[model samples]
Structures are given as structure tokens and as C-alpha cells.
Target: MLGNAEILQAMEQLQDKLFQIAVRVLRKDRTRIQVSYEDHLRIFRLLQEGHKETAAQAMEAHLEFGKRILIH
Candidate 1:
């Protein structure tokens, strides 16, 4: 319901590795999970409202935040 087939395929390709990392990291820090979940919810709502640009920005912020947290 959210993305096209190509987007879904791309996300699917990364799902396994992402899930592994998420499990390892989130197990150690519950707050990170809550933050990421909130990020997703924000993006989902923006997309549902047809605010593609804002949703993209929200997704960008989410990824950037995740990258910072995941990186050493």
C-alpha cells in the first residue's frame, strides 16, 4: 500500500540484513526502537496525507538519524 513494486523489491532485498542489525541494536537500546517506530509512523501519516515531499524529508531524517546511531 505504500510503495511501488520496485521500491518494495529494493526494501525486501535489504530486509534480512536490516532485521539482523535492528534486532542486535534494539535489544540493547529500547529507546532507539521507539524513536524509529515514531519516525515510521510520522512518515506513514505524511504519505497518507499525500505529502510526498514532506514524507520524503521525514524518511530522509529517519535514515540520517539511524545512520548516526548505527555508525561508530
Candidate 2:
């Protein structure tokens, strides 16, 4: 089993990746595609609830929304 430190490190790495993606999306259009705190909380809650598929779909939707903002 992974130790606590190792798990924390992995989570931090995942957070970094998500942050990078958000930054890329914001670079496209900050005014339109800004992710709200509520959105982040909802995604986190879904994951915490063990709804992995739903969480993945929510994340995908969020990213696609960002892409749409860029296209317009």
C-alpha cells in the first residue's frame, strides 16, 4: 500500500495537471470560460461520492465548455 506521503504527492501532481489544463483554457478566454468555485466543488463532491463515471463526464463537459468559449 502507498504511504500517506506518497498518496499526497500523487494528489498534488494530479492537481497540478488540472491546474495546467485550466490555465490553458483560461488563456483562450478568461471572461467567458472561467470555472466557478461551485463547479469545482461539484466535481470534487462527485468524485468523493465514488461516482467516477459521472465525475469524468463532468470534467469532460467542463473542458468542452472551455473549448466552445475559445471557438466563439
Candidate 3:
């Protein structure tokens, strides 16, 4: 598995974009941090359990949730 730094380096551009959008939303609504953290924890737990398929879906839901927050 790639280290976090290595993974970030590999997807720096998209990560940067997400950072930008996330910052905007986070600044406006701090509660988003906990909500986002919950989503992340769900995904992380799924991965840790060796559930790749479920983890992927959790990740997709997390990203879609972020997208919804940004668009509205």
C-alpha cells in the first residue's frame, strides 16, 4: 500500500481541488468536519475490514456528499 504522502503526491491536482472546495465549505459550516469525519471513518473501517467493494461505495458516497455541499 502506498504511504499517505505518496498517495497524495500521485493525486495532488485533484486533491488540491478538493481542498479548495472543502475549505470554502468548512469555513462556512464547521459542523461539516464531524460529518465528513464520520464519512471518512466509515470508509476507513470498511477498508480495514478487507471490504474493498464496500469501501469503494462508501468513498463514492463521501465524494458525492462533498459535491452536493459544494454545489448548493
Candidate 4:
């Protein structure tokens, strides 16, 4: 298991990556893509509102697969 400091560092790095992905997903390949600190805050606010639902859906899908039985 990662130590607390290591986990915090990892989380910070992950946040940076997520911000980049969010920017790309929110503004796909346009001529200008500006993420001011204020804009970043707004994007984070939007994500905070819906991330739980997205995570819950993914967990449900994963659990459903685990619960299924396959026979050959």
C-alpha cells in the first residue's frame, strides 16, 4: 500500500492528468483552449456535481460482470 505522502502525491498527479483530459473532452481540438484558474475551478465544480453518479454506474457494471456465471 502506498504511504500517505505517496498517495497524496499520486492524487495530485492524477488531478493534473484529469484536468488535462477534462479540458480535451470539454473542448475538443479547437484553435484556442484556455484553462484559466477560474475556469479550472468552474470545471471542477461541474465534475464534483456528477462524479459520484459516474463512479456508481461504473461500479455497478463491474459488479454485475463479477456476479454473472459463464458456462462453456
Candidate 5:
């Protein structure tokens, strides 16, 4: 079992990794056009508001679609 700080740290590390992946997968001329921090927070808040399945799937699909567009 991890302490609270350890758990938070792990989550932050995972978040950083995801952000990097998104950046690399969606960067346009070194500009990050992928999901931003604000967008992530909005998604979190929406999930907290009980938007479990649809919003998440939609956001992921939207992100992947953008990645396809920007990466190509």
C-alpha cells in the first residue's frame, strides 16, 4: 500500500507520461495541439458530474481523431 503522497506522485508521473505521449502523437511543428491541462480538468469535472461513459468515450475519440489529423 502506498502513502497518499506516493499515490499522488505516481499519478502525476503517469499524467506526465500521458501528456508526453499525447504531445508526441499530436504535435504539429513542435506545437502541442493535443489535449491541454484545462481540457483535462474539464473532463474530470464532467466525469464527477456523472458523465461516465459517453463523455469519456467522446473525448477519447475526439482526441484520437485530432491525433490522426495533426500527426499526419
Candidate 6:
């Protein structure tokens, strides 16, 4: 079994890769609107409240909003 440190490191690497993929997809939309502090706080709050599904839906909505901003 992997050690705790090893598992944490692996998780961080996976997060980096996922973040890169998100950036690439968003970049293609040519959006200049960046994620704001309020957006982060909102997501964080939902997560802290144990609302994982709601947090994910909020994130998806945020991404969709960014894409729409670029399209218009």
C-alpha cells in the first residue's frame, strides 16, 4: 500500500493534470473573464457545507458562464 505522503503527492499530480486540461478547454473559448474571489468562496462554502453535488453543479455553471461570455 502507498504511504500517506505518496498518496498526497499522487493526488496533487492528478490535480495539476486536470487543471491543465481545464485551462486548455477554457482557453479555446478565448475568455478573458477570470474566476473571481467570490466564485472561489462560493464553491468553497458549498464544499465545507458537505454539498458536494451542489458544489460541482455550481462549478459547471461557472464554466458555462465563462464560455458564454467569450461567445458573446
User: Model 4 over residues 1-72: C-alpha lDDT tens digits?
Assistant: 367998899899999986765455435433323433344455456567877666565555533432341110
Q: 1-72 in candidate 3: lDDT tens per residue? A: 367887677699788977898898787778889998998898899899999999999899877877777787
Best by the TM-score measure = 3
Give all TM-scores, in the order shown: 0.69, 0.54, 0.70, 0.36, 0.46, 0.50
CA lDDT for candidate 2: 0.77
Residue pairs in collision within model 2: none
lDDT of each: 0.82, 0.77, 0.85, 0.53, 0.70, 0.74
Candidate 2: residue 66 lDDT (0-100):
70
User: Residue-wise lDDT of candidate 1 within 1-72, one digit each (tens)?
Assistant: 385998888888799888887776676567888888898999999999999999999999877766666675
lDDT of 5: 0.70
Any runs in candidate 2 off by more than 4 Å, and if so which?
Answer: 1-35
The sequence of per-residue lDDT tens digits that candidate 6 reaches over residues 1-72 is 367898889899999986875666567654432454567689999999999999999998877875565565
Q: Lowest-scoring 10 consecutive residues by lDDT in candidate 4?
A: 63-72
Clashing residue pairs, backbone N/CA/C < 3 A, model 4: none
Off by over 4 Å in 1: 1-13
Give lDDT tens digits, candidate 5, residues 1-72.
Answer: 367898899899999987787667655544434345556677788888998886688688757765676567
Could you tell me how far off, in angstroms, the CA of residue 53 lies in candidate 5 after the best superposition? 2.0
lDDT of 4: 0.53
What lDDT, from 0 to 1, does candidate 3 have? 0.85
